[model samples]
Target: MRTIAEIKESIEADFMRNETAAKLYGFTSGDSFAAFFGKLSVESVLFYLFAVAAWTLENMFESFRSEVNASIDKMKPHRPKWYRDMVLAYMKDRTLIPDTDEYDTADMTDEEITAARVVKHAVADESDDASLLTIKVAGEQGGRRCPLDAQTESQLKAYIAEIKDAGVRTALVNIAPDRFNCELDIYFDPMLLASAVESTCREAIQNYIENLPFNGEYTNMALVDQLQKIDGVRIPELRSATTVAAGESVVTAIDARCVPAAGYFEMGDVKLNMKVYNG
Candidate 1:
């Protein structure tokens, strides 16, 4: 049996040959690599090959487990329903969460979706009933060249004033610069800034705020927009959220996309440290 590295080496040999050929035949560097060539990059090809190997290994292990199960199933004539549920629960935690970037952008498949429903219920049983926290951030930074042109303190102060008028409470809004982006990070007293703003800033703030590069899964708050003037428009996902305690450093949640229907994520995915702790 070929080792995983051996199989990858074999793959690389074929990939190198094609790349060498394409380069020799004037395939420019900026050409669509996935189409004109094969993979997005050398790293992408390697990741895909590894994913295939991992999937293959998983299937092989499952086959072995089935043989074990056959022996056990034969001995147990009347297996309780709880026993079956326990077995299923064990497998759910044991299985590796699929590699999202390598397979699909959405990172979900049919099997994973059905598997998630079971996992969701089980995880729900373990929660301690926590309320969500919001951090309101300024969109500008002083040192870094900002993503947007209006990145001054005055611009941010003005924006906050308007955001407050739009029904978001920015009274104690803690703002700071992210070292890399040099953008002001905002955390609300509560975590639902965009949702609150959606209610108040029905007309004025809609157009401008929509264009901001946000990370949350944004929807138009108008189940019925109370005013006729604020009809039929939606907000994009508000990205780059941060949270900070009094005198403590800011922590930003990664993905704040909570579909009210999918009880799976009441809040978003959060990382306490991207730099110091991630180190």
Candidate 2:
């Protein structure tokens, strides 16, 4: 991290050392000295020297930085939690939707890939021969939280297969959809006219609950706070916030937190059943 002035000073000092060496060898011509050492003071020549020295220093610093980073990374734990999260992040953008070509992603816009998410689960079991590792991946996309089609799922499975350890007797890749429907009962003020309610309230609430940070537990307090902020809504209460599979039975009076069994949270419709009351 030497400053420009420091590096320039060092380069100038080097030029002076070479000038002194020339004088010691009887090569000094007071009139021609300007032709030799004067070149070091010339703006263009000085700039060139500074540039080369700075570039060499920068390259050396980069190599040292990379080595230090590598050592730090190696010293860090390689436990499953860290590895799983790393795999999940690596697969997010690397994954593809059904029937989409690999090159198509480069041409595709950001909006097209905004909803993509990757969830991973590792299971170890002993079989007849040796221990086996089974990695399950769930890829979700779009508003409805649909799963990747067969083709894309296969491609994603192949993409992650390279991370398997050699000691594993067998490594299997499991892929599926992670769509979860969230049912909620939100109470509102009766004085507020129904017509005044925003048509996008359902969408808003859906986005709020859905967009809760990945691997985060959904809290009823957060959801209620967001719902209460809506127009024509007051004293919002989540009577029920049950997480269920798509088309599955919605358990009433269950835990308000939508805790994911796996890492991904494929949010479904808000299913807000609004009740109006004076309280």
Q: What is the alpha-carbon lDDT of model 1 when measured against the actual structure?
A: 0.34
TM-score of each: 0.17, 0.52
Error of 2 at 183 (Å): 5.9
Candidate 1, residues 204-248, lDDT tens digits: the string is 333322222332232333212222243222322233433332334
Clashes of 1: 17
- Which residue runs does candidate 1 get wrong by more than 4 Å? 1-38, 80-279
Look at candidate 2 and give me any clashing residue pairs: none
lDDT of each: 0.34, 0.53
Q: After superposition, how far is residue 138 of candidate 1 from its true place, in Å?
A: 68
